[model samples]
Target: MDFNQLKQELFDYCEEINVQKVGIASTDTFDTLKQRLVTQQAFNYQSGFEKGTVEERTTPTKLLPKAQSIISIALAYPSKMKDAPKSKKGDRRGIFARASWGKDYHDVLREKLNLIGEFLEEKVEGAQFKAMVDTGELHDRAVAERAGIGFVGKNCNLITDEYGSWVYLGELITNIPFEPDEPIEEGCGDCNICVDKCPTGALVQGGQLNASRCIAYQTLTKDFLPDEYRTKIGNRIYGCDTCQVVCPKNKGVDFHLHPEMEPDPELAKPKLEPLLTISNREFKEQFGYMSGSWRGKKPIQRNAIIALAHYKEVESVDTLIHLMKKDPRPVIRGTAAWAIGKIGREDAKQVLEKAKLHEQDEDVLVEIDKGLDFLKVHTTT
Candidate 1:
C-alpha cells in the first residue's frame, strides 16, 4: 500500500473540508511535557481542570494501542469582533475572550475530526482511530506541536505562522503509519511581552503557566475570586486573553474562515447590567452556543458582578443588592456583596447592612464586612 499517496490524499481532503492547517507526527511518549506537568503539580500550579493522570496525558499509546501516528488540525477564529457594542457609562459591557467569541470550538473541531476518521476508515479496512478536542485526555497543544502543526509559543499556545495563536487545535490518534512532518523549529527568541504583561504573573518565567493564577482559569472557577485577582480580572466576563493579545506573532492575525465561528456582537460583549439579572433560560438561550458557557451561568454571572465593580457602574447597584439578598447560590450572593462594596455607591452601605442582618452564610458575611469597611473608609475621607 502506498501510504505516502494516502497521506497526500488525506491532506487534500482536510483542505476540502475547510481545515486551515493539518500535520502528522509519529506516536512517541512526550517526555518534556510529562516532566513539566509533574513539576507544575508539585508547585500546585495546575488549574484542576486537567482530565487525566500525567502518564495518561503524555503517552499516546496508552490511549490507543498500536498508535503509529497522530494527525493535528487547527481552525482559525476571529480575533476582532465586527461592530462591537460600546461599553457606555451606565450600561457597561463585559468582554468574552476571543476564543469564546463564536460557537463552541469543540463541536466544530469534533465534526471535522469525525469526518477525517470516516475518510481513514474508507481508505484502510479495519482502521482504528481516536479523536480528541481540547477536553480530551491527550493535551491537544502537545500533540499539535509534535505533529508539526506549529511551534509551542512562550505563551504556551500553538503559534501557527498562518493563523497565529488565534486558532483552535484538535488531534486524532491512528494506527496508520503516515510519514511524519518536520517539527517547526521556530522560537519566541528574546521577546518577553506575554510574560511581562500577564496580569497575575501566571506565566512563570516563560513557557510555564501557573493555571491557578491565570485569569482565564480563574474566570471559570465557581468560588469567589481571590482578592488579588478580583481587580485584575478587569471587565472580562469569561476568559482572559492578555498573553495572547500581547504576542508579537499574533499581530494582524484575524481570520473569519468558518461561518459558525463568527461572533454575535451582543452576546460576545453583552451589557453588564442586563447580565446581573438574566434568567437561567435566557442565559442559556443567548450564551449556550459559545465555548465559554461550558461552566454555566454562575461563573459568568459572578464575573459580571465583578465587571460592574470594575467599571463602578452605579446603575448596577440595585441589581447587585438584589443578588446579594435574594440569590440562592452563596457564591453569587457573596460576590455581589463584594462588588457592591467595591462600587461603593451612596446606598451601598445601607443595602449591605440590611443583607448583613439576615445573611447566614459565613462567606457572605465576610464579603458584607468588606462592603462595610469600604463604606467606613469612604465616610472617613
Candidate 2:
C-alpha cells in the first residue's frame, strides 16, 4: 500500500482503539529540528552535561534504525473540576491542567506507544517497531505537526481541533516506511495571547522560550533560583501551563475521559497544608512515579512555602518554622525563610533570627533577610 493508504489505515486503527489523534512523519524531520533546538538561546541548558549525551543532544535514528517513519499521537486530559479549583488561593497553581498532575507522561505514553507498536507489527506485514514517550531523541512537537495532528502554537504546544492545547503526545518509530502524513497549516495566525499572558516574559519571541524565565522551568528544573526571578516564579509547584490555558483555541474541550490520561486527585487540587505536612515516606509513596518526583520533595516543598509566602497565609507559619529549623534540605529551609517573610509575623522574626545564626550557606542567609524584610514591612504597616 502507498504511504497515504497506510496512514489512513493507522488513523483508523487509532480511532478504533480509542486513541484521539495520530500523525506520521519521516525520521529526518526530527534530525533537522534537533540541530535548530541547540542553536536557539531559548533552550535551557540541562544541569549536567560535559559533552555529548542525551542531555547535550538526542538522535531518534540511533535508537530505532528502521525508524523510517514516526507515528505521533495525542491524548487530552482536561480538568473535571472547572476553573482550576481553589485549594490554595493566591498561589496561582499556575494553570496546570489535569494532564500534568498524574504519573509522568513519559511512562504513560510509553505504555500506549508500545501497545500500538505491537498492534502494528501484527497488522502490517514485515513491520518492525519501537516507541519513545520522550525517552528517545525526537522532536515530538515537530513530529506531531508533520503528522497533521496540530500546528505548533505560539506557546510551543501542539494545538488540536478537538483538545485545543490540552493534549499529551507520544510517538512510535517504525522501519516500515508507510505513507507520509501531510503537515497541517500553521494556525497561530496573528494571535499573541500566549505571549501577552506570560507573567515572567519568558516567551522571548514567537514560539520561543527562555528556559530561565519560564515558570515551569523555574519551579521544576532550577535547583537554585536567583533572587531577581524568585518573586516572578509565583507559586507553581511543578510545571506551568498559563500559556495554553489563556489561548483562544483551547476553548470548550472535554479531556477528562481520555483512555490513557487521567489526573491523580491529590495532584489536581493539592492541599497546601497536607502537602507541607506529608512525611518523606508518604511523599515518596504519593509522588515517586509522578512527573515532579525526580526532584524529590525539596523543590515542591519549597514551592508550597513560597505559595504561603505569596498569599501571606500566616496559617502555615508553624509549618514553615518547623521546615526552616528542622528540614535537612537547605533549599527547603531557605524557602521557608522566604515564606516567613511573607507571613510577616513577630514569631517568624524569632525563627528567622535563629535560622540566620545557624545557617552556614550564604544563599540561605540571603533568604533569611528576605523574610526579615517582610516582617519589617508588616511591622511598619
Highest TM-score: which candidate?
A: 1
lDDT of 1 by residue, 1-381 (tens): 899999999999999999999999778899999999999999999988898899889999999988999999999999999999999999899999999978899999999999999999999987889999989889988888888888898899999998999999999999999999998989899999999999999999888999999999999999988889887999999999999999999999889999999999999999887887888899899999999999998899999999899998898888888889899999899989988988899888888998999999999999899888878988899
**Candidate 2's error at 30, in angstroms?**
4.3
- For 3-47, candidate 2 gives per-residue lDDT tens digits of 566667777878776677887777663554566566553355332
Task: Give the residue spans of candidate 1 off by over 4 A.
Answer: none
| lDDT score for residue 39 of model 2 | 51
Q: Quick one: best lDDT, which candidate? A: 1
Whole-model lDDT, model 1:
0.91
Candidate 2's C-alpha runs over 4 A off are 1-6, 30-35, 41-60, 80-85, 88-97, 124-126
Colliding residue pairs in candidate 2: 3-179, 66-175, 341-371
